[model samples]
Target: MEQLTFSSAQEILGFLDSALGRDLLLVPVWMRNLAYRLACLQEPDNTALLRRAASDLQFVGPDWNDTAHQLLRSAEALEAARRDGGLGH
Candidate 1:
């Protein structure tokens, strides 16, 4: 994940667009959710990407399963902050 720092929202979106499985599922659900979570943290569209989080994929997680759940919580907090007017677009 560290090697995949995205340059822009489009980069992440491009990856996601390519990964849209036949059943509409992304293979690595954690990656997909992480991207969306990062996007939601800053993008006006919520699902749009930004530089803050995606610029460092290292922050995604230290491990896979349980760590992903923790990252999701942090990402969710960012979203909540945005909703509460603590973060700006």
Candidate 2:
């Protein structure tokens, strides 16, 4: 497994998007896990996590920026997992 270095929700989302492009079903499980992890790391409604996630993406590979945008498109899907009492929250 590749080691992930996400410090915010955006980075997680970006990572998720990249994973999804490879294989939707397979990436969701891990992406959701990372999302939950990122959410947990957040300061409870504070946008610091989002900001951090954005910053983290900059530290990643160039493709991560595009990945982040793709993930942004699937916010509802990600949130749905959280609403269903998934891992991130």
Candidate 2 lDDT trough over 10 residues, lowest sum: 43-52
Best candidate, TM-score? 1
Q: List, residue by residue over 1-89, the lDDT tens digit for candidate 1.
A: 55335535566666666766343444465666666554444353442233333433334454444544544556567677888998874
C-alpha RMSD for every candidate: 7.8, 12.5
lDDT of 1: 0.52
Error of 1 at 78 (Å): 16
Q: How many residue pairs of model 1 clash at the backbone?
A: 0
The Cα error of candidate 1 at residue 44, in Å, is 3.7
- The residue-by-residue lDDT of candidate 2 on 1-89, one tens digit each, is 23454356555556666876687566544445456445536543433444444444544446567645444444545566777976465
lDDT of 2 at 24: 52
In order, candidate lDDTs are: 0.52, 0.52
Q: Give the poorly placed runs of model 2, Cα more than 4 Å off.
A: 1-6, 28-31, 43-89
Write down the TM-score of every candidate.
Answer: 0.39, 0.33
